[model samples]
Every structure is written in structure tokens, then in C-alpha cells.
Target chain A: MTAMTAPQTAPAPALIAAERVRKTFPLPQDHGGVFTVLDEVSCAVAPGEVVALLGRSGSGKSTLLRIMAGLIPASGGRVLSRGAPLRGPNPDVAMVFQSFALLPWLTVQDNVELGLKARAIPREERRKRALAAIDMVGLDGFESAYPKELSGGMQQRVGFARAFVVQPQVLMMDEPCSALDVLTAENLRGEISDLWQAGNFPAQSILLVTHNIEEAVLLADRVLVLGSNPGRIRGEVQIDLARPRDREQPRFKSLVAHIYTVMTHPEADMTRMLAEDNAEVERFRPLPHARAGGISGLLELVVEQGGTVDIPRLAQRLRLDVDDLLPILDAAVLLGFARVVEGHVSVSDDGRAFAEADILRSKELFRQQVLARAPLVAAIAETLRQKRDGTMRAGFFLDLLDEHYPPAEAERQFATAVDWGRYAELFEYEADQERLRLPEPEAVAP
Target chain B: MLLAALAIAAVLAAAGSGIGIGEVGHVALLGLATFARVVVLLAVSTLIWTPVGVAIGFNPRLARLAQPVALLLASFPANFLFPLAALLFIHAGISLNWGGILLMALGAQWYILFNTIAGAMSVPTDLRDMATSMRLRGWRLWRDLIIPGIFPSWVTGGITAAGGAWNASIVAEVVSWGGATLTATGLGAYIADATGRGDWPQIVLGVAMMSAYVVGLNRLVWRRLYRLAESRYRLS
Candidate 1:
């Protein structure tokens, strides 16, 4: 970043400027209506400077780059070059796509010469200029070769040559290295940095779009992070860390971590809120008709009534099948409506109020809990529902049970089952495993 | 065979001398001089046919007009025109030989002209665009860009024209009408006599000799020109 700062004093005027660009896409009525993909995003690139537009998928980084390059028209804002409104693709601005759209029929030299020839330079002069540009991209000896003869990286270099040969004032690269392998992308990035540092021949400024955070951190003097769900600029982070950045260094990691933390905090807070609300709802819900058979059922009943219930009292309320109701109470604690302290199960503060709530409120809270935990049970439920041969590994079945119930109860429920083979297809554990190997459910047959 | 070869060679030489004297000679001269005159006549005819071939190759409009016109001109019996041509030229105080030879060359020139136009029109579109973007326009464009651009077509047209010109010379050299006759000392007159007398061997010999010359010239010259164009100038 110190290396990047040296050129900041006399930063050139904005070569390409976009103001309040908004791109909205209409959705089918059935798909929740219209959505805005880019909302009033504005950014500028100074001449001879490199700026990275960093965003996750669907953040409109590529779209904004296209608009700036005049490849696409912005719906609501103006893109200006040197403070003059851009009408169409200007010769002073050249764009390289990630796909490296090179003309297959032309040799490298002729491809480079395309711009020169279009400008009507004399033949001898065009050849000389095209050769120099081709050499600059390090494709000197491959001048006579066609595009098919070059690798992905080499072809991209040719694309660079084609753009650079024209000596455009601004070069717009749309994820130029995204399609390449890691090492190739790194090499190309180094080459680009070197070129920008040298500042030869028209001295182009670059506006690049990428999803790679480290790439943005390493290359750009400033990285703009866009927020999702109708993509808009969330914040801009200035990386003052010196160039030739060490990715392993504490400073770099902390910066990345800081960005990540800021971006994810909203989602985290929402999850916590939903969990608390569900716990409240569960505590207030009225007990369903309970059969007087097991201590497990009595403990559930006591918890549903918004009362602090102990395992010993729960065991006395219902005739015991097991030595303790501790496992059942533990399972209830894990489900988040009750807390276990010493030997007693009690409603959590949120859960106690929820137990006395109106039915409608309880139902809404129940729905949220189910929806929140749906993904946890979805895989096992799908597997169980689709069972054909009636044999599933026990481990997978136990895992799903453990997610919904506490681990010890889940184990006990399996141990007391009437027909293990009937549900064997729902699990992943083998019958041969020592801890899980049980008498056939018929032998225990209770 | 020897007589037929010598006779055709002698007529070609005479045509060359006709072209050497001046502008009129180049366009209007007739009769024999030496063996080198055959080579000179061949060279001169090639020059006249070059642009005509190119125009026909590059310009569809010219080719459409020239194709049928050439066919009609080539097939028209020069003998049928002999009486009319003789009376008209004699009355106008013009030489019948020059008029007759000019008619023969015209029939031959069309083949070369049309073939050249076909070849030029067929040069690939990308190549045409490359030429255009290089700012090639007008006559220098025609010289450096268009002419070389259509060389292969020119060769095909040239070869076909050479055969047509040889055929045209037969009726051109031997003219007979109303008991007035004019003969050029060439293979065409010799073949005419042989045909009149039903001499099969002489007819066979004249055709064989012409075939040999066509084959030799194509292999030694036209083929080489085409190879250069295909390898160096071809866009693909």
C-alpha cells in the first residue's frame, strides 16, 4: 500500500466515472416480482491507477464494470470519460473479457494489427507497431500462430496485446484472471502490476472486477465491497498495508477477518434473535394429551406447563421403564426450551413467558423453530421417506436422531427399539459395530 | 506431325512480328518473322488477357455480360462471315487478314477474361476485409491488392483463352468466299486442306501438337503462379 501511495499525490483525473448507476431487473410475477441488482452504485478510476470491485456472486461488480466500459448502458445513471458523457464504446477505452474473446481466424500479429489496420495506419508502420505490442505481451515468436495454438493464459495475453496495442486511455478487465489456474492468475497479476508500474505508452488505468478477496487486497489501492440482496455498496475498505503484501502476515489476516466479520454480523444477529423467539414459544405451548406410561412423557408435560420439574418428580409421575429420566430431560434442554440446573429442569426466561402466551403467538413461534431446524432433519427425513430395500446404516439414522433428541436418549431409543431391521435402512451404522450392535429388536421385543 | 507443328509455330511467329512494329503492329499486325515471334505473340496475348481476366473474375456484372458474348463470338463460323468481311474490308480499303486475325484473338480473349473475373469474385470475405482495413482502395489497390488477389483465376482464364485463340486462328487463317480466297501460312490453313482432302493423320497430328503445347505451358508457368498464390497469398 505504501508503494501504491507514492503515486497518490498527483493522481490523474478520473478516466472513467459512473454516477448513481442503478440496474433493476424485472422478475416474473410468480417469482416475487421485480428485483434491483445494482442500486445507485458510484465509483471512479484515476488515470494510471488500478481499482478492484470486490463482491460475491450477484453483486453487480461485472455489470458495473461493463457499464463503465460502455459495453452496456446503465438504466439510471451516466458514465463519463474525462468528465465528458460517454455515448458509446470509445476508442480510448478498451475492454478485455474473462473469456479472452480473440478472433480465431487471425494470427497473433494480425489480431494485434486489427486495431491499427482499423485506424488505417500504413502497412509497414502497422506491422512495426503490432510487433512491438505483441512483444510487450511476450508473444514475439508466436506472432504467426492462430488463437487455437495458444493456451488459455497465452490467449489472454494476446487479448491484452490486442487491447494495449490500441493504446486505450482506460483498460477495463472483467475478471481477466478468474478463468485461469491459481499459478497462472498469479503470474498474470504480477505482469499487470509490472506494466502499470512501468507506465509506458499511454499509461492506462485499470478497473478490474473479481470475487477473490485476496486478489483485491493485493492488487487494488482501494477495494469496494458490495452487499447482497439488491446489491449495493456496503462499505469501502482502504488497504494501507504496503504492496507485495504477505498473505500470511498478521496484518493482512486481521484486515480480511475484519471485512468478513462486518459482512456477516447481520446474518449472525438474525439467527440469534430467531433462536430466542423460538425458545420462548416452545415454553408457553400447552401440553398435548399425555399417556401415563413413561417418565419421559411426564417430564415433557411438566416442561410444557411452564413449571420447573425435576427428574425424580418426573420419574414418580409416570411408571418407570428406565432407571432415570435424566436423558429425556437432557434432550429437552438441548432443544432450547428448558435449562437443566442440579437435578431440576426449568423453563428459560424466554421460554417461561412463551409457555403462558396466546395460542396464535405460540403457533408462530413453533413455525419459526421448525423452519430454522428444518435443514438439520431434511436429509434424514428424505432418506427415510425414500427407503426401498428397508436397510440403512445405523450411524446416519442415529446422527439425525441425535440432532433432534439428546445423544444419550437417542442411544437409548435405538437400544429399546422393537425392530432394528425395520429402520436399519434409515441409518449408516453397520450391524457389526460393537457399541451399536444390539440384539435384534425381536429378541428384546418389549 | 512435324509439318503441323512447324505450321502453327510459323503462324505464331508471324503474329509476334505484327505486334513488334508499333502500336498498330501490336494490335493489328499479321504474318511471319522468326521462331522467337511465337514466344512474343504468346507473351503479348497474356498481357492483353491479364486485366480482362481480372475484371471478369472480380466483377460479376462484367462476367455475366462477357460469358454469353464470348460464347456467341467463339461459335460463330468465321467462314460464314468470310464473304461479308471480304466485301466490306475490300470496299473500305482495309486488309482482310488483320480483320480476320482480330476476330480470332477476340474469341480467345473472352475465355481468359471470364475465368479471371470468377476467381477474383471468389476471394474470401475476410481477406477482402483485411485489404479494406489496410486502406487499399482505387488503382494502386487494384495493382497491389486486387490483381495479386485474383492471380489464380487469371491463370485458369489464361489457359482456356490460349486454346480458344488457337482454334480461332484456323478459320481466321483460311478464308474462302465467292471464289476469292486468302490464306495465312499457318497450321490452320494446313488443317483446312487436310480436312478438305479427308486426311485423317494430318488432322490428328495438328490436334496432338496443340495439346502438347497447352500441357507444357500450364505445367511450366501457370501451375507455378497458382502455387505461389495458394501458399503465400491465401487468406486461410
Candidate 2:
């Protein structure tokens, strides 16, 4: 067998590039704060290639296309065409809207001639070019017919003829076939493909936005899937399936399934990384502080005296905020070490039985001791860091403490009247008098 | 009356020969029928003309041409020209009754022509474009598009022309000149003679017969044609 060699072809440069683009809207405070509809998204389309931006409704795909077209400005980032920034709708770009925006009073020939007329082409030449474009779209004899006289498909063909007459470098279709019936849409697609292959038109690239996944798969060189809730690029699937692709092929189904999985399960693989990060953080930090006793020793003090400890009371005793207390409680709940119900916290029956009966292994005892010491020790370390050799300003110190530690812990650790009073009076702090009065030192310290 | 009928029937038979509607045998029958029909047709046309003429006068385009034409014809005082009509008929060696019918026909023809043209000119732009885009041009365009486009005006003009013909008939039928005088026995003559003798019953009968013929012909023909045109041709 003869040695094989790859075919030599010139590489096409990127014609359109969108980098870290974002669009957002300020929501009414009544409806719940500012809502981001599109977050930072990046995409690029090469010359002569067709790319389909696919998404469900409200996914910001059309907004992105509009931004790329320079019809609207993006709230963040930039879109560049041929290494130059896109400012507004360029003369080299033409867009076909879903509604065929043909002027009713104008005949097919006049509608087709609009773009050239706008450019101030001479009348005779404009007519000639208009007729040629009309003929190309197979509307040869309908030059004088007005929009109302034509069928829907024929009207869309007039729209196509209008766009084609301009000979723009980029043809952006905003769901051009969505309004047409399937057969008409298919015929239009075929006509578009044929025209592109013929290479007579100036439109070097086509960028289509569509909700139909199969349409994207059928028409695009690459399909970009956008996900909702602050829309971002979920995945890009290269459609290497041969041109004139069969939608019935198993390979196509597999590719569609892959896209669906990427769109639906965005955080599937992220969960493992998140869990690993949590483990590493726990390994480096010292354990939480526990009372100087084993489970039985603690049980004797609380249960033997018929005492109670819910999440809030436990948080109060530990001098921790509700937010900081929640993760620890969640972990404890997950491990079956505690039970919380009806805003009341308690040890589970199994937890109580285990505490009383378990002296099973020294390692198990050590683990429980570490778990109990973690929160209190972390809070103390944060407070020390805030104190900073006693040189930090009091107001700054409280802010630092609040940042690092929970509100309850900050309140307790910095409870001195002199410390809080000077800072509060400086900032005009409003303190809850009943819950957090300055302690009388002689009464509290002894 | 038979002589007037025979005269109109000869003219109609000659005209009908072009369209192949009849031959000589039909012409003989048409002579009697045409005479009676001319009298009836004249009376009927008279009653229909005034209301339809007013409608035509209100039309924008036709009113410009129709106002002057109708006024000129209506105020011409055809009755004063009986001696002239008689002298012409005798000098030309044609029957006087033939001249009478021709004069009546000319008076009616203008109403139909003006109204028809006005309605045709009033066709909307969209419908015009629809016709053009369909490549309707020339005679086909005239027959299929223009004729239908102005049909209501044509009907209106036809009704007005009918009345004009009746009004013309009185002056058309009576004639007097030096040593020559002629009169055809029709409703117009009957009305003239009754009025001359102050015969109320005869005058009332002539007027009543003419009014009945006008109402009957309009209800039977013009109304139905107008309904069809309004339904089919007039743009909403």
C-alpha cells in the first residue's frame, strides 16, 4: 500500500470571538434583588463555519447573539470580529429576523433592492442585482408581486433574497425558519446550504440561535449548550458526524445524550472536588473544644440533672452564631450523633445509648474528642488574630472578629464594657440591653 | 304604436345581427315587441334615473364630468324642438318615430356611461395591485378586473339612464311643423292629452302606470344587479 498523506488546506482564522461576555438586569427590590440572566461566557466562530447557540427559553442565548451582532451592548466583556471590536450593527453583517420584515407596499424586486438602495447604488444596477438575487432564490417571475400576494414560504424566500442581495460577510439568522412549516424550513435550509456551497455570496459565515437541539446538530459545525440560572456555557459538543448527517444514527443519539447529561448535571463531578477540599481543611485545623469529660461524663452532668440542649441553647452556651452552628449540626445530623426537631435539639436515643455504653475502642474515643474540640478552638484562634499585639483600633478589631468568628463568639470574647463601650460610642452602636448588658466586673470576675 | 314598434324592431334586428342574437324571422317578431318594450322601457327608466343620478353626482371623479353633462341634458328643453325634429325627419326622408327613439336612447346612454367610469376609477390600490401581480392586462384585464371593479357604477348609471330615456320620450314622440304634425300613442302622449283636456282620471292612470313600471323594473332587475355588485365587487 502507498504511504498516506493528509490533504493540504489553508487554516481559517476566527471571524467572530466573544470573550467573558455577561448581560444582567436590575430586578425590582420587590421581586427579590438583582437577577443575572447571563454570566461570563466565551465563544468563537471561525470563518466559513456555522455555529449554533442552543438553549432553552430565558437562557440568554439570543441576548448573546444580539451582543455579538452589536445590536446591543453587553454589560461585561467584549465581542471582536476579525481582531477588531464590534461597535454596532456593521454593514458587513446582515441579519434575518424570524418574522420576515418585508415592507408590504414594496414588490419583491423593490424589497430585494432595499439594501443596495440604502448604499446608494445606481438605479439600473440596483434593479439588475435585485433581479439576479430574486432569480437565485427561485422567485424569477414574482418581481412585481407585493408581499400580501405571496405565500408564507415565498415571503421568507423574499426575505432571503433581500439578505442575499446585500452580500454581507456574516449572515446571522434569528430562528429564521421557526415560523415556517417543516417542509418549507427544510427547503430553505437546503437552499441556504446550496448557496453557501456555490460560494457566490459574500456571507462567509452563518451563526444561528435555536432552541431545537436537533436543528443545531443538523446545521452546525459545533453546538454550544447554554444552561440557565445565571446562564453560562455548560458544554461544547463538536459535531464530527459527517455532513448531510443522519439524525437516526446511534452516534448522533449518543452525542445528544452526552449534551443532555452535561446540561442537566453541571455539578456532578464538582461534588467530589468539594468534598475533598472539606476533608483537607479539617485535617489542617485543630479540633473543636469540648467540656473536660468523655460522653458519659457529659451525659452525667446534663441528663442525670434532667437538663436540655437544643441548637440555639447549645450555640448560646458555646458563644457561636446560628450560621456557624448550622454546618456542625448538619455534620452531626449526618453522622447520626444528634437529633433536631421542631426547633428543639436533642441527642438521638442511639446517640445516648452509644455514649453510655461505648468504651469500645481508644481510637473512637479520640475521634469524638477531636470532633468536640474543633469549633471553640477555631473561634479562639480567630480572636487572637484580631487582637494583633493590642495595637489594632477597637472598631477595626470588632470588625475583624466579626469577619473571622460568628456574632455570638465575637460578642462574648469582646464583652468588656471598656472595650465595647469606647467602640460602640465611637460608632454609635445599638446594643440589645436585655441580652447583652455590660457585666459588672466585681460580680462577674469572682 | 305598431309603426313605432316596427321602426325600433328594424334597428334592433340590424344591431342584433352583429352578435347573431337573431335573423330576419326574429326581426319581424322583435318589431312588435321592440315597440311595446320601448314604451315600457322608457317609463321604467324615467322613475329609476333621479335617485341614481344624484348618487352619480356625489361621486368624486364622475361628478366633475357628470354634473355639467346631466345639467346640460336635463335643461335642454327638448319639448321646444318638436318642429325642428319634425323638419329634420321630413327633410332627411326618415320616419319621425325613428328620430324619436334615437333621441330617447341618447338621453339615457350618458347616465350609464358616466356612472360606470366613476365606479371603475374608485377601485382600491390593493385590489389593483392584486390584479397587476396576476398579470391581468389589456382586454382580459378590462373584462375580468375593470368591468367587475366598476360594476356598481355601471348599474347606477344604467338606472339613471332609464329615467332619462322616459323624460326624453315625451318631447321625442310629439312633433309639429309647417303643414305637418305627428304623435305616437304611448304613456307620454296619453299624459299630454289628458293634461290638455284636464282629464284627472286619464292623467292619474298614465302617471300611475309609469310609476308602477319604474318601481317594478328596479325591484326586479337593477336592485338584484346592485346587490350582486355590492356583494362581489365592492371592496370592504
Candidate 3:
């Protein structure tokens, strides 16, 4: 790994280091007594390096970022700043939150001066530094304005000003652009990039958490991708593109595509393991957010576009995030309906046939495919069939997934399963009652 | 012309009956005395309860414990406690003048306490964290965060306490239980004295003066402070 990436092989003088960090939140019942957010995650931010932790919603990138920032502690590992263990809020490390985190009653000047005040800086100096910071962030005339009076972008600028005023050694930003519009986000991103390249800011290094792959590629010197369900580093790419990197460049687009490909398709250890063992396949990796309509609609789109399409262009046209679009792509790959390679996804013969078939015939094809290929759906069907009433609580499946994934992700995965099961006419879901029942053999078929 | 003639005639008749200009000096002085007692009682309540109220407000368990107990205490009528206070004052031979203020405070202080507790709770966790991270502790922490956080609540409490104080004076001053009577010289005592003597005109005069004082104070002082507190100390 060191030989491939263009950087010093040995660890350089580090600004902030997190070694084998693990964070686990306690579950209510003490079943396992823990819910793992990140497991055995090791990373170091050498001086002058901006590292981006890029992951989707449940990937726990923000948790990892906070642990490194000393905002939260890791359950099992050491987080050090300049070789000192971080026991609490470190003055050397400041965080800019996505929510702006400004006290509503405080003026812009007061909000910017808060960290300094906390550090017990004298009045005259705190005021001077705060004003300078406000000016630096282009908020000069708005010193007395309250947070409630400011626009979202202006409030975020105040957030930036607050962090910058502290002159921290390590600045951690948790998706600072996430709450702003596209244009506003782009504008802020450009300003930060300018500050970073010009060495105009105090922090020697920054730890940025973002889900947008393009943002990660655009801002970071290196990007770390975390896998879901006990988030651990899945892949790391050192972005070697020159400073002021043009988004229109082929190299930039290719890098974005590379990150997208890695995000959408992880090495399917569960699939490989299940294929090898062929026993108790229900205990395989938890389901993705693959709804029946999205899966079928994606297949239909792939078939219509000559059975092949550019993944990025397809995502842009469909207006689906990689987080949303990846699961559908993964489901297609799982059911042998499509094969995704490089930056393109192509439909298989069965997928093409399903696209050509009538709605009833397509659902019939879907039922056969899901029951044969997807273990979770088959387990639900089997469990419902075994019950005397041919029904079970939806919570039964949810709890099973929760034992492996986070409770939220488990709930979402089970909902996806319910949607697929219902659309395929294998199971009937009563949402208001939250019960799943096997469909009765119909007297009249449509 | 008839309305003006009738008003002048009514004024002349009232003065001639000794229920007019002569009583204004006496009634106005009595109103001032009662106003002074209300002010003193409010000061004492502020000094005693601000810290206590803020303390209970910040502590969840303490706030929960105190809520029902304070409400219970506040709901217990001040008139019901007059007998016990009356007995003590008579046995100790304590002057009724200053003692009436204690009864006034008793009737009023809980309003301040509960309001401060509410304000203390509403101080957002982020502001507290900002203080802690800044290493602000002890008096500075209280001065910067707790006081400002409770200011709006304190103003609300003060308004209610002042109103309660005025009402309590009617019962507090000129306390009577069975055969004994303890009297304090104020509008309340004046009212009681007139009632005992069956002087309906004096009773109306004392009541009208007390209402004027309470309403005037609320309009001139509290309304302004409440507005300032809402703008300055409210942590949205």
C-alpha cells in the first residue's frame, strides 16, 4: 500500500493520530450491551494533510471524525493530539459543525469569541481576534447580527469564523456544506480551498467528513471510505490531483467514478460465504435499501438504454445519490440481473427479458428471483409459512437484523424487505398493525 | 353644562361630608407605606430565592421534587397561616409593622421561586457547555450563565410576587383571630379599620388606592424590565 501511494512510507511527524479506535454505544437491554459504530479504525493525519472520511448515512464516518477531533472519545483506542492523550475538549482542536451550532441569543461577534472566552482570554484581545476572524470570513459588517437574523450560508460563515478565530492546530469540519444550497456550498468550498492552499488559516491539518464523493475528491489530499455495520476502513485513495483541481478534467471525473465504484460495490463477503456454506443463509449480511420498484425500475432503465449505461451519468439523470442508487445496483448484481464494472452497469439476458415482459409476468419473474437469490426474503416466506396463522410481527425480523446492524439500519433494511416481499406477492404487510402475513391463494387471479 | 355642574356639586358635597380633599393626604400616605413594605418584601424574596430557585432549576431531580411541593405551599392560603403568625407576634410582643412584611413575603415568594426554576431549566445545554469548555466556574459561571438565563423568569416571578404581596397585605395587616387583633399601619390596616367601624367610604378609598398603586407599578416598572429581559437574556 505504501509503495503504490505517493507519500512518505514511514509515518511522518503527525498532528493528530487515531490508532485502532473502536466506539460502541450501549443498547437498552444489555443483550450484547453494545452497538459498535466504528471498529478497529486506524488513521493518522500528518502535518499539512487534509483527510476526508467519506461514507453514507450509517457508515459512522461522523463518529470516527468526532473521535479524532476529541469531541467524543473512542471506546477502545487511543486518540492523541501532538502526542498528548485527549481526555476532553482540546483547545488545540476546534470543530465546525454542519448545524452552525451558534447560540441563538449571541451576536456574531460573541459567538466567534466563545471558544476564546472559554479559554479565559482577556477581553481586549478576544475582541480583536474575533473581529479579525469575522473580517477573514467576509462577515465584517454583520458583527452585531444575531444567528437568527443571518442566512444559512452566512451562519455557516460565522461557524467558520468561530473555528478560525481559535487558531487551532487541527480543525475538524463535519459536512460544513451539507446544510447549504448547491451554489452556496460551491462558493464556501472554493473559499476554504483558497484559504487552505494559500496557508491563510491556522490549522495545520483538517479532518473533513462528507458523503459527497466529488467533495471528498475535491478537498482531500487522501480519502478514507468506511464500510457499514461496525464501520471500518474499506478503502483509502490518495488524491494526487494538483491544487485548484478542475472538476471538468478527465482525471477528476475518473477519480470521482473510482470513489463511486468503491462506494456502490464492496467485496460481497456475505454472498461468497453463503455460496460456499449453503446453510442458514438467513444469517447472511443484512439487506440493503433495495425497494421493489427501484430494483425493477432500474432494470427497466438499464434494458431500455441498450442494456448498458454509464453509472455516473445514469445517477445524474435519475437524480439518485450513490447512497440511494448503490443498493439498487447491488441488488441487481445479487439477483444476476446486471453486472457492474469500471464506471458502467450492463443488464443481463434475464434482466432484458423481464424488461420486455408484462407487469404480471415481471412480478412473477421477481418472485422467482428474490425467493431463489435473496436469503432474507426466503427466510421471511419460510417463517410465515411455518406459522399456523401464516403471520409474524415485523419486529421479529427487525430484531434479528439489529443483532448485526445498527437498530436504525435494521429497521430500514426490514422495511425494504417488506416492500420487496409485498410487491412480489409473496407476503402481505399490514403497516398500521406492523404485521407480516403470507398471501392467501387467490380465488381469482388478475 | 349639567354634567360639569353635577360633578362640582358632588365634589363640594363629598368634601363637606369629610370624605373628599381632607382624606387624600391621609390615604396617599397610607398607600406609600404599603408600597414601601411591598418593595422591602420583594427585595428580601429576591435575595433569598434567586440562588435557591436557580439551584433547583438546574438540578432535574431537585426541580421535579420541588415543583409539586412549591405548588402545594403556594396554594396554601396566607390567611390560613395568619393565626400561627398572630400567636407568635402576640407572645413575643413583636411590633406588627415589620411583622406584616413577613406575611406579605410568605404569600408572594413562591411565584419568584417557580419562575426562576423554569428559567434555569430553559438555559440551553450548549450555552452551559460553552461555559464549561471556557472553564467558567463558581461565581463567574453563576454571574454569566445562571443569572442571565434566569433574568426573564425572575422578572415574571417579580410581577406575580408584587401582585400577591398587595393582596396578602389586606389579610397580613390588621390580623384578627378569635378575640385578638394585630394591626399594621398601612392601606390594609386602614381598610380593616374602616370595615370594623362600618365606614364603607374609607374601605372603598383604601381599595381603590391599592389597585392604583399596583397597576401603576406594573405599567411603569415591570413592563419595561420584562421587555428588556425578553430581548437580552432569552436564549432561543
In terms of TM-score, the best-performing candidate is 3
Give the Cα error of residue A118 in candidate 3, in Å: 1.9
Highest-scoring model, DockQ: 3
Candidate 1 stretches with Cα past 4 Å from truth are: A1-12, A28-33, A265-370, A373-446, B1-236
**Residue B197 of candidate 1: its Cα lDDT?**
86
* Backbone clash numbers for all candidates listed: 27, 11, 1
Ranking by DockQ: 3, 1, 2
Task: State in Å the error of residue A191, model 1.
Answer: 1.4
Listing every candidate in turn, what is its Cα RMSD in Å to the true structure after a full C-alpha superposition? 23.0, 28.1, 7.3
lDDT by residue (B17-98, candidate 3, tens digit) is 5786757567768879989999999899988988888888877768878888999988888778888899899989987899
Once model 1 is optimally superposed onto the true structure by TM-score, how far is the C-alpha of residue A45 displaced, in angstroms?
Answer: 1.0
On residues A1-446, what C-alpha lDDT tens digit does candidate 1 reach at each position? Answer: 11111113225578888888888654422234345678898778887567788776557788787677665578788887888998765556766768775655568987777667667779999898888888998988999998878999998998888778777877777788977987898899888876766658444677778776667777776777775545676666677777667778887765655444333334432554477576433332211111112323443477575577543344446643111343344333433445655335676644544455564454344333332442332243345447665345667655644543335544554443312222222233344752223324453322
Output the lDDT of residue A343, model 3: 66
lDDT of 2 by residue, A306-357 (tens): 4345433444465553324443443334334454553344566545554555
- What local lDDT does model 1 show for residue B98? 55
Report lDDT (Cα) of residue A327, candidate 3. Answer: 81
Winner of 1 and 3 under TM-score: 3
Better of 2 and 3 by TM-score: 3
